[model samples]
Target: MIHLLRNLALVSIVLIAAGCDRIGAPVRVDDAWANATPAGATVAAVYMKITTKDADTLLSATTTVADHIEMHTNSEQNGMMQMRPLSNVPLEAGEPFTFAPGGAHFMLVELRQPLTAGLRFPMTLQFQHAPAQTVQVQVVELGSR
Candidate 1:
């Protein structure tokens, strides 16, 4: 009976793993782009649309282009615009989230090198329930829409 139970458990695990889309697909990401940083610039921002298959929390992000990445949301404080770092952001299943300019975005803090147009890099998104997804971000020239 123990051997039979063990086989059943293994099959269940395989079924569950197969239910989730492979890495980078369970959390669907679209329109990932970043702005080209000017010479000597130390920071940059990336914008993207994300939709998770399951209700989850976006816990963190990592990338090779920056010293560190922070999840940020813009707010007004004392009549001044300010951006604050967020510890985590919640996501509703099948609901799309946008990280755009003048709103919530991933701040690439302390960039190792200035981002240039046509450059591409990977940013991995860590979630509470979904497997981490690595998305490619395309850099666009600054001052362009």
Candidate 2:
């Protein structure tokens, strides 16, 4: 009886640990923000951390804030930072992918209008293996961060 009880307890612990992997939903966004920029002739980048519980890919994104939204990454070109567009953002289960300045980021180009503080914009993100999600992001003025 003692041995049977011990085995059952061990099995319960293993089941709980395995369940953790599937408990995380498809995708989650954290610390999403567009870098502060000047009034005119300014380009901005949005940063965030994307987490996926299952293998997925970021297909595309759309928003009215910019004429074009592209996934980009900064690479060293002759020791200088060179930004290049990515084919797609890859996500792995139980992994966090961060999009920050000087790294993997989102290029919000051709600003339709200047982004001012206290302004929030609607943006949508589409995933290859998950449903499209929309998020509201606020604009931070220069000198704010």
Candidate 3:
């Protein structure tokens, strides 16, 4: 009986630890920023670095500054830079997904207000394997890196 009880306790502890692992955030965002839009322009691009402990997908994003946001990638085709929409952004475990100029970015469309330098806005990112996270995005100069 004593040995059976010890085994039961060990099983319970393992189960508890497994549950705890699912309780915290699995991803982290860093260096989030956006570019200031031109006067009267309704579109702006946002960049960030996202690191995840496990494989995950960025499902969507929302912000009050735009009617909608889309994941986009800029590529040079035929000597012209073009932007294309992405359905979702995949994050690899222990790898940082860097969103920067001339690469992957979030395109904000139908802006509610013009994006000006030195302003900050809130962006909520939803992920497939983690809870939604809100991060403040700083609007920087037009040519900021």
| Model 3 agreement with the true structure over 38-144: per-residue lDDT tens digits | 98998888999998877899999999999999999999999999999999998998789998989999999899999899999999999998889899999998886
Sort every candidate by TM-score, greatest first.
3, 1, 2
> Can you write out model 2's per-residue Cα lDDT over 54-76, one digit (the tens) per residue?
88999888888899788999999
Per-prediction TM-score to the true structure, in the order listed: 0.82, 0.79, 0.85
Positional deviation of residue 32's Cα in model 1 after best superposition, in angstroms: 0.7
Q: lDDT per residue, candidate 1, 48-135, as tens digits? A: 9999877899999999999999999999989998999999999998899999999999999899888999999999999989899899
Q: Which whole-number lDDT from 0 to 100 does residue 92 have in model 3? A: 91
Whole-model Cα lDDT per candidate?
Answer: 0.91, 0.82, 0.91
Against the true structure, whose TM-score is highest? 3
Clashes found in each candidate (C-alpha, N, C closer than 3 A):
0, 0, 0
